[model samples]
Target: MVPPTTGPTHHLGKSEIEYYAMLAKTEVQHYSGTNIELGTACGKYFRVCTLSITDPGDSDIIRSLESA
Candidate 1:
C-alpha cells in the first residue's frame, strides 16, 4: 500500500509497520490511487494508507486485481 507522494513511507509510522506485517502474511496488492482516494473508495472519511481485504465475499475484486 504505497501512497503516491510519500511512496512507501507515509507520515503515520503504524501504517508502514502494518504494511510490512501484511506483506509477510499474505499477498499485498498495490493501490494506484492516493490514500485519500483509497479512503473514499472504502467509504471512509479519512486517509487510508493500508487496507486488508481479508475476505472479498462475493466481490470480483480479487480476480480483477490479480488479473491486472
Candidate 2:
C-alpha cells in the first residue's frame, strides 16, 4: 500500500482527519445491529475504546467526529 502524505493544511487535510476518531468503550455499549460485526467476543480490547474510521478520500468535507 502507498504511504500517507504530510503537506500543507488544505492539500493534505484528509490525513489529519484520520488521526482523530470516536471512542466506543466496552463499558458502555456497541452493536453493529442484529448482526454485531465484532461480536460479543471482544476481550479486554472490549474494555478499551474503539476508533471509528472514515474514508480518507473524502476531502470535500470538514473533519468532525464522523469524518474523523
Candidate 3:
C-alpha cells in the first residue's frame, strides 16, 4: 500500500507487523484518516516507536558502542 510520504520504501514483514502490534497495542491502519489518527495517537501516548530502518541493520553500531 502507498502512504503519503513516499521517499522511502518500508518493508514490513509478518514478524514486523506482529512486533509493531505489540508495541503500538494496535494494528497498522491503511486509510489516510485512520492512519493519521493512529499516528497522532502514537505521538500523544507513546514515548517512542521502535521500528527499524536501514538494511544490513545497525548491529555494528551497537557493537562499536560497547567496545568503546
Best by lDDT: 1
The segments of candidate 1 whose C-alpha lies over 4 angstroms from its true place after superposition are: 1-8, 11-25
lDDT of 1 by residue, 1-68 (tens): 22223244455765665567677765656677777887887789988777667677997777777687
* lDDT (Cα atoms) of all candidates against the true structure: 0.64, 0.29, 0.38
Model 3, runs deviating above 4 Å: 1-12, 27-68
TM-score list, all predictions: 0.59, 0.16, 0.22
Expressed as tens digits, the lDDT of each residue in 1-68 for candidate 3 is 11122112245554565565668665332322343453564355522223332342644633432364
Q: Can you write out model 2's per-residue Cα lDDT over 1-68, one digit (the tens) per residue? A: 11222232243443444343223221212222222223232223232123232343764322332343
User: Any residue pairs clashing in model 3, and if so which?
Assistant: none
Enumerate clash totals for all models, in the order shown: 0, 0, 0
Per-residue error for 40 in candidate 2, Å, reads 38
Candidate 1: deviation at residue 9, Å? Answer: 3.7
